[model samples]
Structures are given as structure tokens and as C-alpha cells.
Target chain A: MVIYGVALLSFCMLVGVFLGDLLGELIGVQANVGGVGIAMLLLILLSNLTSQRFSLAPMTESGIHFWSAMYIPIVVAMAARQNVVAAVSSGWMAIIAGVAAVAASFLLIPVLSKAGRGRPE
Target chain B: MSGDVLARVLTENSLIAAFVVVGALVMVSYWLSARLTRGHIHGSAVAIALGLLLAYAGGVATGGSKGLADIGVFAGIGIMGGAMFRDFAIVATAFGAELEALKKAGLVGALSVVIGVVLSFVVGALVALAFGYTDAVSVSTIGAGAATYIVGPVTGTALGASSEVVALSIAAGLTKSVLVMIGTPLVAGRIGLDNPHSAMIYGGLMGTTSGVAGGLAATDPKLVPYGAMTATFYTGVGCLLAPSVLYLVVRAVL
Candidate 1:
């Protein structure tokens, strides 16, 4: 059954990606099926790498791989526009964002740690 | 193309000498970073410094031969971060006063990452709308790719969205990649997510938002080449069989 489940999950993800293109075409949603496909491929590779020990449950890695692939290609497509990026690129922006991410990581990680206290899942 | 760039720079500028100089600096940096850590983490500063040395050496040695050295620098960065993560985790596990505290911290770290992604996207989109700007998507996409490829791709997925929401998904992706480049050693020093597989998974999560953000930023043909690979790789797994398993679990729990 586990084998069947893994096999079935693999098949469906592949088909969904291929079919997602057709669905996008039909629905006129402009979904980058190729990008989605790429996300899926990367996720599968990731799941395979990490799922051995930290896989909270069977197929957890696989499942996260599936859902995560859904949104990434869209982000990539947006990045392709060089002209637009050139107009807004700034040293300050980079500095600010870098600072912000670090600050946020420092502040939020610890806070979240505190909040999660006394709560057992 | 990257190889040619390196070769041209090396030949035209006599960069080999620079390599030796930088290699020495990197060694010193490694020693210093290690000393600074004071056993909080181990081997990271040295590893990063070594990696930097190797990068310079590798780049010079390979002379852009198949661009393997360039790729190694990126991988080395990720490996360093993974090593750091492993070190930190081990310390947390060994030294943590409460097992629950460690678990909570991990959960918090994960959630903050998620929240950060969403907020980044919101900021990105708003900036895009207000200034009538674009192009950061590529930065984010590439950033995320660098992150995931180096760390495992999951981290890229998680942080990718932060860039997307703010319309800097590509930058975010690239940032993650750079972070992997720089942070790997630091993270490795303090904690060790020593497992490459786990690192890759984390990389994927980091890249995910970047992918989404990249797609949202534009509908460009050129971006897809860089942007789509990570998305396709991660989502392809989903298409294969992963989602259904998730569905079953949700169903069972519900």
C-alpha cells in the first residue's frame, strides 16, 4: 500500500503539471505550467534528500513538495523582466531589504519560540 | 558564458595573483570566524574561509573549465550553512534545557520564515503597483534558485515568496542564494543541519515563495529559463504522487 501510494502520488503530480498547461489554456489563466513543472521537479529532489529523518509522517515531504511547487514558477516568470528591474534597482533597496530580513529573522524567530511555549501539539 | 567571463577577467587582469592573495585572506577569515564563535559553533568559520579559498583556487584552477569551480563556490556556501545548522541543532538538542523549547524554536523559525515570505510579497506587490516597477522578480527567482540548489531548495521555496510579495522575489531568491553562500558557514558553525537532504528540503521551502513571486512579477519569456527550473522540479514531485498523500492525511484528520 505504501508503494502504491508513492507511485500513485508520483504519477498524479506529473500528470497534473502536464495537464495544468491544458487547463490554463482552457481557462485562460496564464498559468506557467512549465514553471510549475520545474517547481515540482525541485521539490521532489528536495523531499528525497530530507525526508529520511525529519519526515513527520509518511509522505510528508512528498506532500509539501506538491503544494510548494504550485506557486514558484509564477515568481520566476515575473523575474524575467530585466528592463523593469533596471529602472528600480538601488543600493539602498538592497541594503534595506537585507537589514530587514535579518532583523525580522532575529526578532520573529525568538518571539515565535516564546509563543509556542506551553502549547503541545 | 560564465566561464568565458572568468577566463577573460583572469587573463586580462592577472587575477591568479589575486587568487593567492584572496586565498590567504580567506584562511585568516576562517580562523577568525572560528575564534569568534568560541565553541558556540564549530568548524564553520574555517570551512567558509576554506570554501572561499577553494572558490578562488577552483576558479583559477578550473580556468572556467566547464564552470565547475564557479558552481563549487555556490555549493560550498550551501554546505557550510548546512554544517552550521547541524552544529546548532546538535547544540540545541544536547544543551537545550527543555526538549519542548527546541521544538518550539524550530517551529517558530519555520513559521516566521513563512510569514516573512508573505509580507515580502505584499510589500513587493505594493511597491510594484505604486512605483510602476518590475524586474526584481528575476533577482528573486535567481536568488531562490541559488538558495535551493545550494541548501536543498526548500529554503528557497519558503523565502522565495517574501521576495514575490514585495515584487523582489528574484532578488529574494538571489538573496537566499547569497545567504546560502555566506550564511551556510555561519549556520554550520553554530548548528549543523548536516544532512544535505534536509538542507535541500529547506532550500526548496525557501525557494517556493521566490518562484511564486517570480511568476507574479511578470510574464516574460527570458525569465522562465532561470525561474521555471526550480518551480518545475518541486512541482513535478507534486504531480507525481505527493498531493494525494497529503489529501488522505487531511481527510483522515478531518
Candidate 2:
């Protein structure tokens, strides 16, 4: 039952990656175009569809949860490493952009807070 | 099998081995965060710092283009860290969200996302300008990064920005994520960031899902779901806006 969930996930990923690659080619870019995002969207749709049509076994449900929990940490670790390598080699502009974004976001807090105050809840 | 055969097997499975190594590193990072920062700083931030340090070291040691992947054993990192997993994680997070709760945020949540994306893009573009990046693609890509790290590369790639600029955009997003993780708890009380409504608004205003998730977890664990729900939409809104509307705006300005 758990294996079914994984199979489903894998299926979604395959299609998603294919579409992403196709999108990239069509756009004249040499990279995958939101392949993972596409896969996840597919998964969400399929899972919701399946759940409504037929209840998932608890084991299958748990299997999905296990993978989902692992997803963020593993992805973050991998992405962060790649980003650092890219930033270090890209000269000072990257660092400046990063710092500026963070600083500006901090400045925005006051403005956002003030704007948010109108809502009573 | 002989020792040579065993070595060859290990080399062939280097990618799996790399995952193990990364997992260990994550544990160490969490331990360091707990011990050193007393958990004030999220473990994700620490893990990222350590990851960056390792990446730099790997790059220096091998002089290879793929960072640690240049080394024989770490080559799997290239695949593991690729967009496939990144997008999968993002999409999977959405599966658990309840749609009805999202509707509860209503007009305010939608407004926050619009305002948040535009404001962040403007700030990012200004930073790009300040750094002598005069081109619209580069400026908009970086601005999108301010929207969220996910948006940065997506916009950059779509607009044909140099890989270096795209990388810079990611760095910009990462920096914002780390800061939000550390700053949210400190400012939570003062800014009235305690309730679910406020958390949803906060998530909309701050488009970085990881940052918002980590920050909310620190501030109030209960609010994590609410914050992450709207934060997910923020990314979607950003992805839609960055390359289209915001890019057009930047192009028109320059």
C-alpha cells in the first residue's frame, strides 16, 4: 500500500520533469522549467482526486507524510549548497543583492505593520 | 570481493553516500544551533551556513565547476540538489494544506501577497541598481529573488539572465530567509504577530516559505500551518508576477 503512494509520486515526477524540460526547450532556455513545481502540482491533484474517489489506506497515507517531511530538509540542504557555490563565484553583486534584500525586508516591517493595523483580527 | 572491488562499489554509490554525509551535516548543524544559539536561530540557517562553508571548501579543493560534485564522491550532490527535488518539496507541502482555511484569510491575505511581491521586487531592483546592474533582466531577476528564492531562478532563467545573476538572486533570497528566521521571534510580540489572522498576513507579506515557516515555528508553533498556507500562495503569486508584471515594470523604468 505504501509502495503505491511512492509509485504515484514517482509517476507525477516523471511527467512533471518531462513537461518542465519541454517548457525549457520551447522557451529557448537550456534548463528545466519548474519541473518539480509541476510534479508537485500533479501530485496534489492526483492525491486529492484519489482521496475523494477512494480512501487511502493508513499506511499509504503515512508513506506520503514521511516523504513530505523529508522533502523540505533535503531540498533546502541541497539548494543552499548550490547557491553558496554560485554566490561565491559570481563576484560581489550577489552578496550585495542578498544583503540589500534582507535589509529592505527589515525596513518593510514597520510599513507592513502599520498597514496591517487597520484589520482588527 | 577484493578491496579494489569494494572501493569501486563505494565510488559508484557515491551519490547515496553523499546523502548520508549531508544528513550527518544537518544533524551537526541542528546540534550547533541548539547549543550555540539556544535555538533562537533556526537550525535551517545553521545548516545553510555549514553547507555554504562545505561548498566553498569543495570548490577550492577541486577547482571544479560543480563545487563538491567535482570530487568523485560528492557528484551525487548535483542530482540531489537539483530542481527536481526542490520543486517536489514545494509542491508536496501544498498537499497537507486545507483550502477552506486559506479562504478565511480573505481579501486581506490577497492584498498582502500583492503588496508583498511588489514591494520586495522594488527593493531588489533598487539593490541591483545600486550594485551597477543596469540591465532589466538582471534587476528583475534579483527583485524576484527578494520575492522568494524559488522565484529568483525561475525569473532569471525565463528572462535569460546570466547564471551568475541568477545565483546572486538565490543568494539574495537565502539571505532574506536566514534573517527572517532569526528576526521573527524577536519582533513577533511587538508587531502583534501572534494570531492566525496575523500569521496568514505575515506569510503573505513575507514570501519566503522557509523563512516564514521557521520564524513562525519559533514564535508560535501553532501558527506554522497558517503562515505556511498563505506563504505558499505568495510563491505562486510571485512566480506569476516576477517575470511578467514586475519584469515589465522594471523594463519600462529602465
Best by lDDT: 2
TM-scores of the models, in the order given:
0.34, 0.69
Off by over 4 Å in 1: A1-99, A118-121, B1-41, B49-113, B123-171, B180-254
lDDT, candidate 1, at A108: 40
- Fraction of true interface contacts that also occur in model 1: 0.07
lDDT of 2 by residue, A7-63 (tens): 777787789778867876675544455455466557767877788889778887766
Q: List the residue pairs that clash in candidate 2.
A: A98-B172
lDDT of 1: 0.33
Residue-wise lDDT of candidate 2 within B162-221, one digit each (tens)?
A: 988887788778667656765677777766787766777787788776677557655665
Model 1 agreement with the true structure over B29-97: per-residue lDDT tens digits:
456656786644333334332443453444455443211123432332222223222212111111102
- TM-score for candidate 1, residues paired by index: 0.34
TM-score winner among the candidates?
A: 2
Per-prediction DockQ comes to: 0.07, 0.31
TM-score of chain A of 2: 0.69
TM-score of the second chain, each candidate in turn, equals 0.32, 0.66
Candidate 2 C-alpha error for residue A47, in Å: 5.9
